[model samples]
Target: MRIRQRCGERARKRADRGPSGLSLLPWLLMGLGALSHLLGGQAPNPWIGAAGLLAFNTVYIAIVFRAFDRSRRESPLTWGLLVTLGLLTFGLAIGYGREWLLLFPLLGLGVGAVVRRGRLLPLIAFPLVVAVGAVTFWRDGWGSIGIVYGTFISIMVTAAILALDETVRELRETREELARAAVEKERLRFSRDLHDLLGHTLSVIVVKSEVVRRLAPRDLDAALAQVADIESVGRQALTEIREAVTGYREGSLATELDRARDALSTAGIEPVVRRSGPLLAPQTEALLSWVVRESATNAVRHSGASRCEIALSGSADRVRLTVTDDGRGPADGTPGSGLRGLRERVAAAGGTLDSGPAPRGGFRVTAELPVEASVPPEGDPAR
Candidate 1:
């Protein structure tokens, strides 16, 4: 599968080169036809010389038809008929007189204008036709130095027009690529935001609903409180989703710690928090906040734990967080959705998170984040 994909990519790149390659074909045909004319002049038999010139013109006309067909704007059969007409004109040029040869280049220009239909085509073809006509007139004893000067001007104009066409094509392609990249970036950003907003809210709602089911017949007030907590959680989830959509979502370590405390207290588990960290980068802080929330949640929902601890410490270069709970670890022998999301968030921030059973008799989670202060030296002592 991988090999096939690589081959397909190479083919696409080769196809993208077609436009520039086709642009060079007309000039190559003209150069080769001119060479054939010169060589025919040296042939021993006049008939053989004429036949050689006819063959060269025929091949050039065939090439023009193929170029038009590849463009797909014109019908291949129509261009093929045009090629036939061009061949007849070449024959008439030879039979009528040598002066009639001047018409061939002009005919080529007319065919180019019809088939190419681009602004650059006329600009390139017009001058070449006039120059060929002037050269033929000079050969027939109607020459002037002004005709040669005009030919040089024609060549320069043709080159300038083609250069402009190439520049416009490059600019259009660059704009398309940039637009595609922006769309992809926005898609990824939204996906991450949705995950962050909905995952924990849904998990908490499920846990509370289960608890309310067990306590409803025994204690009506306790069931009502659980229902209220569910409503509050739902509202908070809606607010976070709105903020995420509006690019206004922000998180802090202190706020997450408070929530963690409340969750543990409600679960009848003692939660101990120890902090000794400098201010964290926004990305690191947000990620650590999510970690704290997920750890506390899993401790309540999955583990039958009596105690939990969350510890945070940081210096100038590195920060570490550890969450431990004394519980019967991982009942089903599979990690839950909360743990999976926590793993992804930490990994994305260039940090690591490990969660498994503690050898003594519980579950343990540890995370580390690296931070770099972006302030320049002596920028401001107090800002």
Candidate 2:
């Protein structure tokens, strides 16, 4: 499965590079023209005319293939080569038949595909080539009207090929730009997850280390127990980190509350948790859990507070969670990276998040999510 996916991606990347097989289109059209000429009527010297037509086709094919190549296109040498081919084909047609004149306009079309410096050259040159063919047919007085109509038809065909080539070029550019944007978005998500995971875990470990330092001299047994708890927390943090790397980790409000209480206790701060109203959906519960964990981590790591409070409440239409601590708030009112990411997450869930200093003291983070907001629809992955 993985191999197939990789192969499919490689194919798509190749397609996104540019249009393929463009050089063959001109030859295909020329082949049809040759078949039509052969079946139209008898010729004075069919073998000689066929040899001359084959030689013209060889030159036309080379010019067209080179015109489509981005590296050599639009060079002074390339346009000069096209002009030479056009004159040669026109001279050959004068001796062979009016049919050979049709090949001349193709040279103009190929040059127009590249060398945008002379944008009007093909429009001007094609009509002149058509007039020359029409005049030649007039001199012979055989199917004169048909010659005029065929000239215009050839011009239309050339115009369609040029337009298609341009559209393909634009599509390739847009595809590459979209791929770049997707990669940048994934990088941002991974960085945000790593910061949140490691930040909270490391903060808890620091607080527990402080507890061990204080208890070791007074109560060796108690300090040993704290060390054991620290070791356990470290192992759990490692497991969570691994899960986070694979994007399979899920947060729970209940689990965050338990860990927050333990972290507060280790930091010598009291924890008070309260929940009310109906239960929340799993997604909402997970979102709130992250908010609580981040808020609690900030309270323990930054704010020198003695108490922290966590509250969860739900109404018929909305669920709200708030984390508050009795500690000095942000000196400049600017939120940290975790809170910024939390705001984005909550908004994606059709929710709102607010954070600032409490009216009394310290910092407060609040989140409210719509209870009735339906899960993301089928084919619409979660944000």
Best by TM-score: 2
lDDT of each: 0.64, 0.71
Determine which window of 10 residues in candidate 1 has minimal summed lDDT.
374-383
RMSD of 1: 11.6
User: Which lDDT value does model 1 have at 301?
Assistant: 73
lDDT of 1 at 209: 85
Clashing pairs in 2: none
Error of 2 at 83 (Å): 15
